[model samples]
Target: MLELVKKNIHMNRWKTQVDTQVTLDDDFIVPDTMSDIAQVILDSGEVQLEPARVQSEKVTIRGKLDFHVLYRKEEGGLQTLGGLIPFEEMVNVPGLEERDYVSVSWKMEDLNAGIINSRKLSIQAVVTLEVRVEALFDTEAAVALGALQKEDDGSGELTFPQIATKTRAVNAAAIALRRKDTYRVKEEMTLSGSKPAIGRILWMEMRLSGALARPLDGKIRLEGTLLVFLIYEGEGESETVQWLEESIPFSGEVEMAGAVEEMIPAIDLRLVHKSIEEKPDYDGEMRELALDAVIELDIRLYEEQPLEILSDMYGVNRELTVETGEACFDQILTRNAGKCKISEKIQLSGGQRVLQFCHSSGLVKLDQAEAGEDMLSLDGVLEVKLLYLTDDDSCPIQSVTELLPFHYDAEAPGITKDSVWYLEQGVEQLTAVMAGGDIVEIKAVLLLEVLVLQPVCQSVILQAQTSPLDRRKLKEAPGIVGYVVQEKDSLWDIAKRFRTTAEHVMETNGLTSEELHPGDSLILVKEIVR
Candidate 1:
């Protein structure tokens, strides 16, 4: 009997992307203290996903759309209104089970806000969700093969012959950790004396930049900078709209049960909730701001493992037959990062003149991604939102949105259509300026990162069947003969066919290399069995 060795591999089982749209049509009532709406200026939205539930053949996703609206009051100034709309969706996924681990990710494609009445507002948004499943199983291969025999020592231990078995090294990536967690950042900052005190906060936004996670012993260290922007109403008699921008550095650590420094980490970070509120300073004036942010993290780690497996085996005395089957493994292809630069000009219509550029935000939406002969082609659109001050007295604050299309090709030598991959998209270094009375110049650098994993299929030995050699057949076989090397013939294959060991054939023929050419003559010698 031949001994067999096996190893367990963790890999992706099934993956799919589902695009669904949820409409949140509800009336938002204006507060009594705020004035009625006359004209809407800007509307934006953000999505927050709840803990997903995985069942047989389906996944239940629940979330809410948090939206903000900036409108000109009928009484003559700018006011803000905000609300939340809840949504639930059921995604149909075949071959999914409760015990399987599922990963869910989502993005907001578009959001539209309209006015229904002076006291009410209408809001709607579209979202897309992606799902991936993973599993673990064992693969059996003949790493070493030898007949068991008692040792000559008195201990009587069975030992394997070193020259009878051979092995080759194969590398694979194994999963070490897959988990999800959240972290909250609480900070406070006081405004400089030169800046005016805030009466009320009108609009605020926070973005996480240069975020990274590193693994340690039983923990993961997180570090990033927060880009904070806000516009508020002044408390003094000036009563003008003032804005402030700040970059705050933050760092923290999260506990991961089995994380280690040697593992490779792939982390996804998102800001699920954020808020900036006004607080009174030591002088009893509202000059300080309190910042609270919630970030959700989806983390995965992989460890590279080298496996030694038996490629082929044969017996000199006994007849041996090897059984093989197909197996698949997920191999890491590459982790690449690239950037695209976008520059465009917007011509304002309806007699609108730009007095000052306030702020700009960008979001990247991927439309297509395909793998070519030696590259990965990506097609996407960058949605930019611009806010500025207009020269018009009636509507001093104005906002506009523009879509810029971009195409980028990354160098990926061996990528294919069946490859498992993902591209992480973001915006960085966004700037907007006025070129002329009606032309607004916009420039932004869009960041793109991709990770590719390819599945490799190979034939592996499953088991070995052995039987005693027939004496009559051995007697009829020739003891020595001249052999001609054919095309694509290996020394192991030729030796096994002639009932001899490869070492004996090489020693008898005095060959220096295993490279065999057509019409090459070789001498064969049969092995004698005891």
Candidate 2:
């Protein structure tokens, strides 16, 4: 018989896999009715994946990519082309059964679109997808604290040692909520005295600046803003290219039952269905426009689970058997933010003057991260790219790329070196200005979200040793002998086999660690006689 104690435990875990070789190859030809293609520009692209279908041997996934293409026509000035390409593939994963939850994400890079001739175009892009499968459950473990009754012939009664324990909060429950809303924007603008009405829209982009979600009694309130920028050509004598900007605010409520203010919400916003039709009006020598779009917000809700964990235990009088398991729990959630800027004093290579830039794009990447007791240290690089036109009043556009190194220290309370963290970074704003000379100033905001997890070990006592009344056992001789260590050998197992304690063997062998090689020599002194 053995002593028993019970405690509540919570565990949350997920295993993720990434596939980068998702083939994305498609070709489109310029219609013979339209003008010839002069220059092809890649504005932006996004991939949308459906829920994964799991089978016995492999999983099937289907998705589509939406990309906008800008082409300068040989006869016409500029034209915008949009296309939707569908793709599907199968991936082999062992032990992947049906009814398993799978979350998917994908990114596209290194896109190349070449114009073979004025009528034929070829496009190729590389896509990477990440899938995470997760499951949550609750369980209990029984631990051994102490016992008072025992009978020993050669040993006296001993008290039980203190048992180490750990407490944590895991994922108790989770749910998903989805909502879609529409936005309407309209504004009046003015051009130069010689500029004409808006003839055509060259390129347009929409990026989320900031978003927040808070839970109510039975609903979730969401708030955010979208930054809309566009490049349009004026119907003037020179047909100049103009840059325009607008910030649209949106707020709404989503229905979610049993949701409280203490729960955590993971937000994913997408342009599931949208239409940005342009209606330009000509007033004397200026241009006015209106924009409209529909956006969707997908959120994941999670509840915290608190647990008490048993770490270590032992028995002095009789042999003890312990059953242990491993689990992971959430530790902390903190938002880190900072502003980093890069300013340089340089001149143009040639005698070209600098016109107004279209837009500044920024991307952040983390190279290394370290965690301390109360803070996190991060090392990363910020890459900035700008597109600008020269002073020749021509239609040629030039581009430049820059890299900035940065280090940030974020305060994380109650975080230790043993915890694991997951990070997601976003850019708040990016701007570039022509400072005095050919010098350019670039400024950006960096936002980081971290999720920390702590792993715990749970143990329970299964059985205790039974004493035999008959004393007909073999004995060991007391002597000091030298033994050579071999593979698959441990000091604890050797001491138990020789009827000696591990402490006495270590004191005699002068060993610092238990790392024994095949040719290492050890001295064992057996002093117990039975």
Which candidate number would show the highest lDDT if scored against the true structure? 1
TM-score of 2: 0.66
Expressed as tens digits, the lDDT of each residue in 1-530 for candidate 1 is 45666676765433455556565667778888889999998887887779788877888989888889888889786789998998888888887777777877777777888888898888877777777776655444556554564222112333332223446677666677888899899999898888889987888889887677778889999998888988888897847888888988899999999999997776788888898889999998999999999888888777766778776776566666778787777677777888889888888776877788888787788899999876789998888888888788988888888988889887777899888776666786788888877887888887777777777777777877555666678878888989999998988888878877777888899988777888999999777744
Show pairs that collide, candidate 1: 143-310
What 10-residue stretch in candidate 2 is worst by lDDT? Answer: 161-170
**Candidate 2 — which pairs collide?**
none
How does model 2 fare in lDDT?
Answer: 0.59
TM-scores of the candidates are 0.92, 0.66
Best by TM-score: 1
lDDT of 2 by residue, 446-476 (tens): 7666555444433433334434222234223
Cα misplacement distance, residue 411 of candidate 1 (Å):
1.6
Candidate 1 weakest ten by summed lDDT: 152-161
Question: In model 2, how many backbone clashes occur?
Answer: 0
